[model samples]
Target: MEFFSQSLAEALSMILSMDQKLYAIIWLSLYVSFFATLFAAILGVPAGFGLAVASFKGKRAVITLVNTLLALPTVVIGLFAYAFLSRSGSLGFLGWLYTPKAIIIGQVILILPWVISLTLTAVSRIDLRYRRTALTLGATAFFASLAVLREARFGILAAVIAAFGRAIAEIGIAMMLGGNIKGFTRTMTTAMALEHNKGEFVLAVALGLVLLLVSLGMNILLQLAQGRYGERV
Candidate 1:
């Protein structure tokens, strides 16, 4: 009890003092997660929209595969990414191994399926008649697609939030692909793990506390956005 209290007090001090190293870790975590989510959204949403709207052979198989991949473990992704990014691998020429970019790549792969599946759900729920209505009004197929996307915007936002949350909190990708390099690729989760391994209890606790706060704050913001969106709609 006494030890926990002491650790908590030190954590408060670290936060209040604006510990540069701590902030740097936090910033890198957010940076990688944000860009990863962005890239994933770009790739995933369109695929999802296509899955929702287009018809083709093996469509059910593809959808089932995507839904299954949504539950793929971060560690498995890390291993596969590492294998591909290593010097002997096909993508090795890009030389992304053990770097922030590597972690970003892993994160993008990790979240994309979930984004796609969620997006498919969102777009699928919209009545197909809307597309017919728009096309009947002389709108291009592109414009009709846009109408569906706009209506499904909130669901897409939710998907992004969920992806971002997962990316930020995940330790496996950061540790394995980023190599947890200090001041360069280290993230909150990796830092916490490193501190714990090194027996730096106070700093580990601090990082954990901050990670929790970050996750909580993001969720609160999401709820507020949903509220505002609801009112507007």
Candidate 2:
């Protein structure tokens, strides 16, 4: 009990003192997750939007594929990434394995489905009247989509925030793709795992706190967005 209390105090000190190492790991975590979310949004949002609005064959199959990907385990994703990024693997000439870029790639792949699925749902729920009204005003289908997207912006933002939360807290992909290299690819989740394995609790506790705070903040935003939009997420 005494040791737990003392260690907790020490962990608080680590956070209060602005520990450079701790902050650096947090920054790296944020950097990787941020870019991962950006890439996912860039690709997923449009793909989702198109799927929601366009009349195309095989669309249901594509949506099912994206939904299925969301169920993939993080380690499975890490392994798949390794196969592509490993030196002996095809396209390995890019040398992305065990790097922050690799971590970003894995995280993007990990969360892309979440973003796409949610965004597609959001856009799909918008009343067709909006699209018809826009068309009646001589707006193109693409521009009409922009209006529907605007109307559903809150739900889409929530999806993005949710993706960021998932990416920031993931460990398996970061560990395998990033190698948890200190001062580089190391992120909060990976660092916490490493520290715990070494029987060092303070840094791990601190990182866990940060991860919790991030998750809390994201959930709060999501709730607010959902409440305002009155949409199911």
Candidate 3:
């Protein structure tokens, strides 16, 4: 109990002092995760929308694969990305290994499936009557798709929030791909692991607190969005 109390106090002091390295890690984490989520959203939203509106051969298989990917091991992703980014690999010319870009790439891969699957669910839940009515009113396919998307905007927001949350909390890809280098590729999760491994509980605890706060904020946003769109859903 005494040791734990001492550790907590130290953690609080470190956070209050505004440690530069800590702040750097936090910033890098946010930056990479933001871009990763953006990349995922860009690719996932359109793909999900297309999947929802179009029926074709192998659609079920694709969705199933995406669902399976949601649970993909981070280490596996790290290995796959590392292979391509490493020397002698196909993308080695880009030299992305052990960098923030590498972390972002891995995170984007991790979140893409979630975003696509969740957005697909959101789009699928939209009433077909809306699309039919839009068509009956002579709306073009593009406009009809837009109207359906607007109607399901809240659910899509939820999906995005979920993807962001997942990306922010992940450690394996960030550590393996980013190399957990201080003031560079280090993220909150990777920092926490490094600190803990070094028997430095203060920074680890502080980063953990930040991670918790981030998770809480995302959940709150999700709830508010759901509340606003409950009737529409």
Candidate 4:
């Protein structure tokens, strides 16, 4: 009990002091996760829309592959990325290994399937009549898709928020590919792991608190957005 109390006090102090290194780690985590989610959304949203609306051979197979990738281990992604980014690898000329960019790349891969799968689910759940109505109105294919998306916007936003949450909380890819460098690649999860391994409980606990707060804030925002727009869909 005494040890717990002491550690809590120390953690509070660290958070109150606004440690510069800790802020850097937090900022990097947010930046990388944002870009990763953004990239995933760009590709995933269109792919998901096509999957929901278009007919083609092997579409089921494609969806099955995406579902399988949704469960892919982050460490596997890290290893795959490392192989391509390492000095002797084919794409080594890019020199991204052990960098924040490398971490973002890995995270994007990890979350892309989630975004696609969830977006597809959202689009699929929309009423088929909605699409037909738009088509009957002489809407172009692009406009029809846009109308469908707007109707299902809340669910699609939820999918994106979920992907962002997953990317930000992930540690395996960040640690393995980013090398957990103090000022550069270190994220909240990675920093917590490093600090705990070094027997530095305060920073770890403080970071954990910050991570919790971030997650809570995201959830609140998601709920608010859903409440405001969910019924319109």
Q: What is the lDDT, from 0 to 100, of the residue 138 in candidate 4?
A: 99
Residue 19 accuracy (lDDT) in model 4: 86
Task: Write the residue-wise lDDT of candidate 3 on 159-186 in tens digits.
Answer: 8999999999999999889998877888
Ranking by lDDT: 2, 3, 4, 1
Better of 1 and 3 by TM-score: 3
lDDT of 4 by residue, 15-110 (tens): 889888778888999999999999999999988988988899999999999999988999999998999999998989999988999999999999
Model 3 misplaced regions, further than 4 Å: none
lDDT: which is higher, 3 or 4? Answer: 3
Task: Give the C-alpha miss distance for residue 32 in model 1, angstroms.
Answer: 0.5
Roughly what TM-score does model 4 have, to 2 decimal places?
0.95
Best by TM-score: 3
- State the TM-score for model 1: 0.95
Residue range 1-233, candidate 1, lDDT tens digits: 99889988998899889999989998999899999999999999999999999999999999999999988999999999999999998999998998889999999999999889988987887777899899999999999999988887877787788788888999999999999999999999999988888978877887888889989987977676556545535
Ordered list by TM-score, greatest first: 3, 2, 4, 1
Range of the 10 consecutive residues with the lowest summed lDDT in candidate 2:
224-233
lDDT of 2 by residue, 112-168 (tens): 999999999888888768898999999998898888889989989988999999999
